[model samples]
Structures are given as C-alpha cells and as structure tokens.
Target: MAFNRTRWAALAATVVLAACGGGGGDIVPSPRVPFTSLVSFGDSLSDVGTYKVGTVAAAGGGKFTVNSASARIWTELLASDIKVPASCPAQTGLLPNVPGFTGAPVTNTPACTNYAQGSARVSNVFAPSSATLQAAPFNQVNIGLTAVPVTQQIAAHLAKTGGSFNGSELVTVMAGGNDTFMNINGVSAAAGGGAAAAGAAVAAGWPTATQQAVAAGGAAAVNAAATAAVTAMGQAGAELAGLVKTQILAKGAKYVVVVNLPDVSQTPFALAADAQTRALVNQMVTTFNSQLAAGLAGTATTVVQVDVYARGRDQTANPSRYGLSNVTTPACSTTSPANPLQGSSLACTTASTIPGDTSGFLYADSVHPTPLGHQLQNQFVKEQLAAAGWY
Candidate 1:
C-alpha cells in the first residue's frame, strides 16, 4: 500500500504524546504545558518586521518573504499554532543614507517581543545593510537594520523584563547565517587583493587574523580567511549555546527551542557561487552546527534542538515531496524598479514577482524564502515541538 504521510505523522505524534504520558486513547492529545508567549531571536528567517519602514513599508514588503497581509513567517506561524499572542517586532527602525530613500529612526515596541532582525548575526554587530556598514565602501542601501547581535538581543530582553524569564514564554533562537556570509565575503576579498583590502574586510567583523596572515595575500590569504571564518562560525554557535544556558535558562526560561542553521549552500545565492565558495559555505555550516550541538549536549531536558540543516537538505533533494516547484529560481523579479534593494526579498511584493504564479516556489529571492518555504519551516518546527510535547 502507498504510504500516507498524514497518517504517518499522526501516528508518530500519538506515539510521542503517549511516551510523554498523554492519554493513549485520545485521538488528539493536548500539549504537555501551555506557552504564554513566544520570544524569538535571530536573522531574516525569523524576523517579523524589524525593518518595515520607509520605502520597504511603502512597497508592502518586510520579513524577508513575499510580503502581504497573509504572508506570515515561521515565528508568526509557530505563535499561532501554539495559541500564543501574535509575534511582532520588539524593535523597529531603518535609517538609510542612500538617495531617494526615506527611513525612520529606531523605535522600541515595549509590548512586542520578537527581537529577530534581518541581517542579524549571532554575536557580530556588523551585518549586511546594517547601520554599522552604511559608510563609504559598503554603502548599504534601503533601510539600514540595527542588526543587533543575538547576544545583545537577549540582554535587551532581560533588561526589559527585569533580567529574567517568567518560565512560561516559548523562546526560539535561529542565527549565524549572516556570520557565515561575512566570512565568505572576507574570503572573496582576500582572494581578490592585498593586505589593506583584506584588513578592511576583517575590520568589518569578517574575521580576525594574525598580522603575518593578513600580509600573506594570494592563496595563503584565502586559506587564512577560510580558516578564520570557519573557526568564527564555530565560536558563534558555541556563543549562542552559552547564551541559552547562562542567560535564558539560568534566568528562568523553561522551554527553549534552538534551531540549527539551514544548509545555505543549497540556497540560490550559493548556487550562483563558484564550486570553491559553495564548499567553503558547507564547511562553515557544518562546523557551526557541530559546535552548537556539542555546547548544548547536556541540556536536553530544558532545550530542544531543531535540525533545520537536515530538513533543508531533504527539502532540496526532494522538493516535490514538500510541494515545492522551483527550488533553484527566485520568484521575485530582480530588475523591478519598485524594489529599492533590487533583488532583496526584503522589498519584494506581489507587484514585483515573476510573471507566473510564485506560490509554489521555494525562494522569493536569492537567499530569503517565499511564503511557502516559510510554511514548510513552520511545519517542521511544529513537528519538533509536538514530538517534545511542548505544543
């Protein structure tokens, strides 16, 4: 007989619920514990709308997906599934110095708690389109995200809530993609030129290197950059784990779900990269996930790990199974004048998408997901949460 995925899922969920002491006779089991609110931290993948201002707001685009009233990212979906308050940006702002672009100053929303921001890194303060990179050479256009690192995001939350969780919020963390991107950019810069250029890249939070390595240039420089980038990613993962343990858990957080990095090497952005760059990205992701797992090894009771990497690999390998039609092509039109960031999904909307229907596409742009992709991610998270009896 043909396998029924829905039945299989239901059976698995029942089994998990039974193992967690739910009633075996019940067709649908209740959650083990109720979650009061959802507190999120990370980059664009989890961002609800930290940069929904000025031109981006005018174009009805934000959250790094095909922006619309119904376009909810994974975090929002998770909030709804768990029956918690709707997620909203904890902070919002965009101050771009680019011509023809109007931006709003940074503002804090005390009532909201979704802290994830587009282009945010795990610990690094500098990120793409960040206010830190708005000077001369980088000249990031569109709205400049604050790009507050995840470490500080937690700190800000603690400061806001009197430095401790109430043990009822469902905390989710997903970051480090931007850190990998910075490292890759450093490698590219090192491969292209002398110590001065490489040093500048490193100064932008790319990676640190010994004086000799920076002065080496050539293949030596490339190797040094790659090594540094990989090492830094591992450190980032460890840092995130550390934050969860010492900051969140120690402060009274009970249900924390840590999402590992997805295999970005399979994204359209990486698909456009050379073989060497793609390989480097894969290595960086591997190193980060390994370190994160190692750091969180003994915290199984309070922490649940979501393997987005494995899920992403499976989805890319078998898109049809996930109802994805085009995993390789972006659904957004890169040349549309309506999108100030050009191809960035942060500004993509229904008006700027490709001619055909894009609801089945996996990606909205080169790096960011479409609404369908976000839904797949939400489903994956829900399954994990259910298995852990947290939803």
Candidate 2:
C-alpha cells in the first residue's frame, strides 16, 4: 500500500520530523511553539486530572509517573528556555513539574486551567466549557474514564467556550491507549473463558471484558482490532489535525504536537499471557503505526511522531537501564489482595508509585501507565519534544 501523502498534504499538515529508521536513534525534540501557554487535549497520558474525583470509576486524581517536581512533560518543556525564541522561564502552571528541582510551580495555564486530564479520552465526559457547570469528570479533573475516544475529545474541547485555542498555546496530544486496551479486552471476551484464562494466569488481574466478541482467530482477533484501532486513531489524528489547523494553528496555535503510539506488543500485560500473542501484538502495533504515519501524511502542519514504543519495545533486553523494573505478574501480588492496582506499574501505592518499577510493572491495573510508567513516557516525550523543536 503506497502511503497516501496526497490526502495528508491536502489538509495542510507538514511534518518537520526526520526518519527515525537509522543510526542509534538519536533523541530529536521538536521546538516548542514559543507560545504563552500549551493547551493540551487527550487521555491519561496527557490528562492532568479532569476526571479525578468525577467517578466514571471514582478513582483518585492524576498521580501517575509524575516526576514529583513541577516538571511534568509540559512544565519541563517550558522550564529552562534561556534559548526559547522570546519567552520568560515558562511562567507558573506552564509546562509540568520540573525534575530534581522542586519549588512553587510556574504555570502556563496558571489559572489552574490546562485542558489536560489524567486518564481522559479525547472525548470523555462531554465536559461543558462553561467551567461553572461542567460534567462529572470536569468537576474534579480526572480525564480518565469517560471511556471516550480521541475524536470525541476534540469535539468536546471545541464545544467549550475557552476550549477553542490557537497557535502554540495548544501544545500536544498523548492519547489512544485506552481505545487499544478496550479493543484488546473486547477480543479477549470473544474467546469463551478467555477472561478467566487470562485472569487466572497472572497473580494480577486483567481488565474485565465488557463484550463477548472474540477475534475470529484468537490472537488474530487482537491483531484485527489493533489494526482497526490504528486505522481509527489515524483517521482521528487527521481529522483532529484538521480542527487544530483551522481552529488553533491557523488562528495562531502555530504547532500541534502529538505523541505517537508505542509498540503495543512490548507491554508486559499483553506478553504475559502468551509469547505468540506478544509477537502478534508487536507486529500489529508496527503495522498500525505505518497506517498512522500515512494518516498524518503531508499536512504543512508540523506533525512529529515519536517512537515511544521503541523506548520500551525491548524491555526484556534492557528494562533496568530505562528505569523499568520488568516484572512478570501484573504488578499485583497474589498474596496481597488489599492493594488496589493503580496504573500500569502493577504496584499498589498511589503517590510513592512510579511506572516501570517492578513493584507494579505488572498490575498498576489501569490498563495504562502507572505514574512510574508515565515517567518513562515523560522521558520519551521530552526527548521527542526536543527533537521536534518543542524545547
């Protein structure tokens, strides 16, 4: 399938990023939009806590692998800008936490207003923009649940009064994991006893299936769904980019950055059940990315895709180096039932928890990043942001 760059270009999207195919894969962070603020949109990875106490699941607020410093990804990007075209050291609430260095946070959206919410889907909550009369998720700021997809999130943001942002102010998107998980779990349910079989395998538990549809070919089912998901996400990316360009970039948002999907096959959660399954997961992930690249094809917009998966793709080979603790069971210990599995780490504690740590590598439970895991992503995001000139 020849990649259709024509359509992508038709949308005025432009990717300044270079191919990551060769050499030792040097870190490439993109230049930040030199804007006053970075209004984010998406799920847990980007969610600051829009859904925190709203309770689709009633879970706590954003506590994933935050560096604990004010330097969360967004914050860090804005932190040390002695060289940024013409900006002050990102004001309070700007970017995220700063690392190793802790102090009062300088904010980009200091009004306590950044669109990001932990665990939020692109379209979760149908959250209204009035701010005063928001949805359950918006009230607290969890961003998770709402069990929505990325496309919807974009629309919802557009619906908000202040949600409409432009040029540089809207920085990036880090979403779509839950969509994949939901797809995977749906496939598992199709195979009778699939849930129980998967459940019984590791000490930690797998997500309960909401559907009973199985992949026509077992693991193949997951592969098919993955392909569909990638396709859907790609289409969503293009469409959302359309909104970004017209609504934000054209008006002034300047740049719209997005974090690419990582290697799905590499996740311990998928691999633990079956080695073959793992390989399939990885393969589909790669295949899906190809489709995604095409979807993001030729727009004049600066579209940079980061290989976040590569960072964790070969974890078995080098988990320790990336700060990954590489555990087998889903972060949950069979012996300790009291520990409520949180994010991807499989560990139980909330704050003390970091992603990729063996403590919860298996059971951080949320089908997504444990705060520690997010730390790993933060590293990838920062590096890519630099590569994309977001620094």
Candidate 3:
C-alpha cells in the first residue's frame, strides 16, 4: 500500500488542477448549499457515542471528551451551527471482557447518522480496545469499542441511504489517530522483543513479519518494523482519501470535510515515550497528513481540508493565544478509582477533573480534547468550511 514519490507528485499535480477548477470553468455563482443533515464518519474525535450503553452509559460516559449531557464534541457543535438536528450515533454497542459492565449488543439507529466510533482506524479492522486485540495474551482492559474503521462506516452510511448520498448532507471525516497509535504500538512491541505482544500488535495489520523480526532481535529488525509501520500509516492515509473520492464523493456527496491527523506526538500520551519514540510518532503523523492532503487535493471543490496538525502545533507553541492555560497537562484525573476506564476521557466528568479551573485546559485525557479544545476545533472547521463556501 506504500505510495512512491512519482505517484504522490502526480497526485499533487491533480490537486493544483482541481483547486484551479479544472481549466477555470464558467464563473457561475449559486446560493449556498442547503445542508439539512450533518453526516459524519471517523474515530473518537468526531464520535457522538457509538458505545454509549451499559456501564459506559451508566457512568455518564460516551464521547471522548468529558461526559455530560451538555458536553459536545466538535461534530455535534458543528451540527448545531449548521441548523441540523442534534447528531446521534448511527450504532451503539459494548462487548467488553471485563466484569461489572453489562455488554450491550450492537444496535442500529437509522434516524441518526454520526458513524464515528472511538478507536476506529482509517481502513484497518483491528484497533485499540477492539475485541480481537483485547483478547488472550494482550488482554487489554476492555473498554468495548467496536473500532469499525472509517471505510466500513462510510459503507454503512451508503447502505442505509440506499447506496448513495442525497448530495445535501454536510459530511465530516476525522480519523487516522488510531492508525498512528497502532503503528506506534507495533514498533514498541517489535523493539521490546516480546513475541506475543508483537503478534497482538500485528492484529492491527502490521505485517506478521514484524513479529518474526522481533523474535530475531536486533536493531536492524526493529528499524525494519518502524519503517514498515510508517509506510503502512502513509498507505492508510491514502486509503482514506481514496475512500473519500471513490466511496463518498463518487456516491454523490457534495460537501465532504476531511480533517487531517493532528500531531499526536504533542499529546500527553507521547510524554511517556522516549525521545526516539516521540520523534517516530511525529514522523508517522506528518507522513499520514502529507499523503492524505495529496490524495484529496484533486477534489478541492467538493472536499474541504482542515489542517488540525498546524492548529495543534500552534496551540502548543502559544497556548495563551488560543485561550488555553495548559496544553501539556490533561484536565481529566487519570488516577481515579471510581472511573472504570481510568485515565480515559470517556469516563471523565466535571467532578473527575484535576483541581482548579480546567475550562481552559487543552486536553481531557492523554489523547482526547477537552470541551474548550473541541470548541477550538469546531471553530477551525467552521472557518475552513466558510472559506470553501460550503458552510
């Protein structure tokens, strides 16, 4: 799935042509596109709660941000601004292996259209908290995320909509964070020399050879694993862009807003990693973003690209400018016994935050954004959409 330089260069050219409107067709202006529905697809960042049942629901936990009736992720906030009905999860379920949490069978809500789920990757079926990866030797504490990749999320939407969009829906996509995470985990396992752990990481679609290479321990093997993981990340980005063009746009979606991956290396999650690992994670994020931008450049008219990476970096560099008081510390309490998913923003509430005013904090957990952080993202997306004349 790796893309060579020539292919990317050609794709970049397509972006230029498309941005210019393919030979500058007649300058015809029309009324703003009427968006009656806000359709969304991606991971936890945009998730409106695909796992808001059982213990998670009882704990008032669902979306990645602080869980409360009033808490709104960026997508939900955007839906409000667009004058559409409040978005709800297209599906809901939780099949965790842990006790005390009652597992809910997967249920579909045809009326809702937000397809984003926590832990979803771009195209990979296996992801963090997924049943397959949480089983046996890995035995990750089950949070019960379905982790249905964005590719299938789009398919589910198409199937429910009679195989095509109505062209009036405002679609937003934000994924690949989990893909980058899986790659990082793969690299760690391969380098740590744990065969079982490496095998489990391979379930996320890193080549099985990575596990074998780990067994035959050496710096060269570890480097090979890192290279393969990064290459796969770029491929995942390209795959997402291809899905957007072929599955979404080709199926009649007129307004597609694709939010690129943010720099996860800047998140609190990376603070625990060594310098080398953090650098590797940064490389993976940039690589994914680059491939995604190149792949979607050709459809500039219909696709709006939101540069979240740049925004995140800016927020990190100058937190005060963004009204953020703390960019490095997570607002949520990662050490709460009452919280079933300790350290996860999913279980975080106003009562569970670190002491003092957390309203200005940028993160809710190691990886998810706080409400204010989501607001910034919401504002950023609206700005992008307005600039593209698609809002």
lDDT of 2 by residue, 304-380 (tens): 56665565544435666545554333443323433222232212334434334444252243234444454455555
TM-score of 3: 0.89
lDDT of 3 by residue, 1-391 (tens): 1112222221110100000000111122322667889999988888888877887777777778777768888888778877789999999988887777666999999999999888788888777767655666666666567878888999999998899999989999888888776676666655456664466457647667666776564576568777877898899889989999999999999999998887877877776566777788889888988999989987989999988888788788888887878888877776676456765777778867888998988888777888788788877877777778765
lDDT of each: 0.75, 0.39, 0.74
Lowest summed lDDT across 10 adjacent residues in model 3 is found at: 13-22
**Separate clash counts for every candidate:** 0, 103, 0
Runs in model 2 lying further than 4 Å from the true structure: 1-33, 54-61, 65-113, 117-144, 159-164, 193-251, 314-316, 323-367, 370-372
TM-score of each: 0.89, 0.58, 0.89
Q: What is the lDDT of residue 187 in candidate 3?
A: 65
Which clashing pairs does model 1 show? none
| Deviation of model 3 at 56, angstroms | 1.3
Better of 1 and 2 by lDDT: 1
